[model samples]
Target: MAGIEFEIMEHIGKISEGKSGWKKELNLVSWNGNDPKFDIRDWSPDYTKMGKGLTLSAEDLKSLKNVLNEMDI
Candidate 1:
């Protein structure tokens, strides 16, 4: 299976109740070192239908770290 990694850029807001709120905008990036072929603008993940928030498996997180380490970027 092809490995995938996700990165999130969030804009956080501070609430009057002394709580922090974040809106996560995600980017699914690949380490292939080439331009992405698909359109990211059309990409969407319906967390409500999936019954979960954004998350990754342990193995996937490890792989992503490895890729980043190897690239040293």
Candidate 2:
């Protein structure tokens, strides 16, 4: 596979941290210089590496927010 390119447009927040100095975070990212999107994934301490994660568009993010708001807990 070809190398993936990405830019962290915004650092939203950290969800959790692991013992390996990797942290699960939510951020806005642009893949291959395309438009930015909401991303949730794990990144190494220096951000030189990342794990598989989910990417969502603005519409999807709004839907997710609605779902979360409706959840009892």
Highest lDDT: which candidate?
2
| lDDT per residue (tens digit) for residues 49-71 in model 1 | 11123334446656776998999
lDDT of 2 by residue, 33-58 (tens): 89999999999999889999999999
**Using Cα atoms with residue i matched to residue i, what is each candidate's TM-score against the true structure?**
0.28, 0.93
lDDT, candidate 1, residue 25? 34
- Compared with the true structure, all predictions reach lDDT values of 0.34, 0.95
Model 2 TM-score is 0.93
Candidate 1: 10-residue stretch with minimal lDDT: 11-20
lDDT score, residue 20, model 1? 27
Give residue 50's error in model 1 in angstroms.
14
RMSD of each: 13.7, 1.3
Error of 2 at 37 (Å): 0.7
Which residue pairs collide, candidate 1?
Answer: none
Over 4 Å off, model 2? none
